[model samples]
Target: MSSKVPIFTLSNGVRMPSVGLGTWQMTGDEGKTVIRNAILAGYRHIDTATLYQNEDQIGDALAELFAEGVVKRDDLFITTKAFCHEVAPDVIEEALRNSLKRLRLDYVDLYLAHIPAATRECGSHRTDVKVEDIWKGLEKLYSLGLTKSIGVSNFNESQIERIVKIQKVPIHVSQLELHLYLPQKAHREICKKHSIIITAYATLGSPGRMSVIGADGKPLFESTKNIPNELNDKNVKALAQKYNKTPVQILLRATVDMGIVVIPKTTNPERMKENINLFDFSISKAEVNLLEAHERSKPERLFWWPNVSEHPEDPFAAER
Candidate 1:
């Protein structure tokens, strides 16, 4: 099953599996079981964040998989993010070290800044931080062997340019809320120019995002009540029918065909298999074009963190 999945080579020459299991709002013993099941279903890459509060559970699950000889540490690629105060330049290294302790790993395959925004531990946004400052910290982590590669998330073009100007290490990956509704063509082009591999979250419109709580214990997706769900998109459904595959499969396969990595989350055992089985089929260029036709006039973002605008580099400010 692992051999069936294709890999994308990052600019740093690291190999990341195109399809990874997204673990957001997945917690407790139940989350561990689901994570273990995701790997059993053939996922070699797993995405997590310190904000997810489930790294310990994932750590436990992976330990079990290792004990059973299901997978070796090198056989998998694990990516984790540091958000909020963790993005602080001074706190960045310690935050990642703590994350490593939670993940029970010496180093993660990829470590993302998660967002350009920074906040105080009390949830108040901090506007004084610069993205290049944070990039320097991530670069330090890379030098210390804390994370194999470093990148940014939820950054606008200007912010990306700012980091690129002063980067000692190139941004290796860009994880963003990309879906058929908001294909992010411009962002993709910028990343392509920089040779930064994009790891797309919310690829299927992220209905599951509604469950992700914010810093204040409220659902983040509630603020953006009108997100376009790809599951309800007629064009995507038609492509799914034409291809004789589930709509979920069509949407995910299209994103992968674009050379963008996707991490769609699900707990159903059957959906797990379906998500990883995408390698068996292929979508033609014309059909991919048809899917691309559904791009929303404006980008649709699911997470609008509280007081996000207070951060100088709020990437979604224009969208709001």
Candidate 2:
């Protein structure tokens, strides 16, 4: 099987794979095996975070691949984030070093401020930190060559603007939980204006996972009984039939066609292969619009992290 995935050049001239393997809720031998298989199946990008607690396993997988001559160190694009608690300016470099140690790498392709808000060790939101302060640390990392690019995640337009105003280097990327249900057009427009690439997580939404719960201790979805599954939506199904592709493929292709990078996590090797095979087909403009229209009138973010919603810098705040 050919192990080739399409690449998109970042504003900083770094080449990033259009689709990456996400290592969230995965670790140990299982995480290593899945990451290895993903690379063998043509995934050149791997997204992880210190918060995920799987950097060591991912590192082992990369080590094995290099030792076996399956791929070179420079052949992959690795991305990890600074946990919310580590976003403090004083601790940024130290946190990055810890992540690097775990991933067994000297430098990362990209390093992101995992979340806009800062939190205490006990996981309570800290009101003292500002997004700009954390961004200054990222700038330091960029200048030191520890990370080729630095950016933010789950940040709103105002928060991004705050960083951009004080930024010496361009924000290279802005990762968000983007999908058919939450296209985040406003944020996408902001990123486009600044030439910041958007790396979409949760692209497939809650495919097979248990229903998410909100801050109110209530199910996010009232009932799977009456609501239609996005993957099984009539519109998505119709497009799948038209393209002679699976519903998942149609959904992923739609995101790629929009020039957005998507990372869909799955431990299943077969699903991993299927997720990266998006380069073979193109979704037409009309079909693309049909998929885009699937976006909800009001976004229903699956990972709002309500505990931080009251934080001043909370991107999910009503004012934002």
Candidate 3:
């Protein structure tokens, strides 16, 4: 842990770094190198999931670092999630053990339910498996000390509330696709009231990934044209100039100022260095207000799963 980066204390009293490296699309030897470089670059926290398929690479990097005495096991905070299909009560522990095997670690600092919806092996949504049942499995893992803490990702307020009401352990964090363009204020408020820390992914507005062309090479989201790129936004650029910082720094700082943790992924060494160098500067209250005002009145979600939206517990479809 770099002294420059601050750490947030979870409700369970675990310390988590406020800024982390997200290993979403990173894989293979290249991904291993990226994880190694990020650790050397002062990133004490790293986020990955079973769906990412790069846990082994991350494991390799951490093993090297630990073997070389570059960092101790306790010095790092690693988080991984169980895939939606593995959320069933019977499969939860097995799924976690498999992830631990891939990560080459005895335990993970935090484990999350990857999504609110459940799925079967045939790639079909399972409406019968409820969130409460999956939560019981998470509680089992926590009690066994397989994970120091447990949480959820991509869960809405109502779904989170349902779990919280029946859960024996408190929800430690809620990971979401949040950035300047899509602040998700409503969801943030709900989490805040319940003492659930917000972990933001796609913190950069996912610059070239907002819209993807389909198999026929056409746009995926209809509102893709209406979404503004935060990196190129006039307001962001002006703020960068005013603060003598890059747009990325300004955007990341905005989230940090609001007490939100950000995990911005990048394999570029230079960008990795730049992402963690956000603590030296502080965005003023007025400037933060102006930056927050840049949020769209209507949400422009970059990630949408229309196929799973029909699920009864679909977090996105549920009202806030």
Q: With candidate 3 superimposed using the best TM-score fit, by how many Å does residue 189's alpha carbon deviate from the native?
A: 1.3
| lDDT by residue for model 2 (1-320), tens | 23456677889999888889888878778999999888888888999999889999999889889999999988889999998888888889999999999999999999999998998878898898999988998999999999999999988899999888988998999999888877889999999999999999878875534444556787655443343456877888998898788888888888888989888899999998788877677778988898788766666566766557788778888743
**Model 1 lDDT per residue over 1-320, tens place:** 28988899998888999999998878898789998999888999999999889999999999889999999999999999998789988898899999889889999999999889888888788777878888998999999998888999888877888888999899999998888777888899999999999999888777777766767898766867676677888887877787788999988888999999999898888999998889678999988998887656676766565567756778877766
Error of 3 at 218 (Å): 6.7
| TM-score for all models, in order of appearance | 0.95, 0.93, 0.94
Q: Which number leads on lDDT?
A: 3
Q: Per-residue lDDT tens digits of candidate 3, residues 291-319?
A: 78875667677777565678877877843
Pairwise lDDT winner, candidates 1 and 3: 3
Q: Model 2: residues >4 Å from true position, as ranges?
A: 1-4, 208-228
The CA lDDT at 144 in model 1 is 96
Error of 1 at 121 (Å): 1.0
Best by TM-score: 1
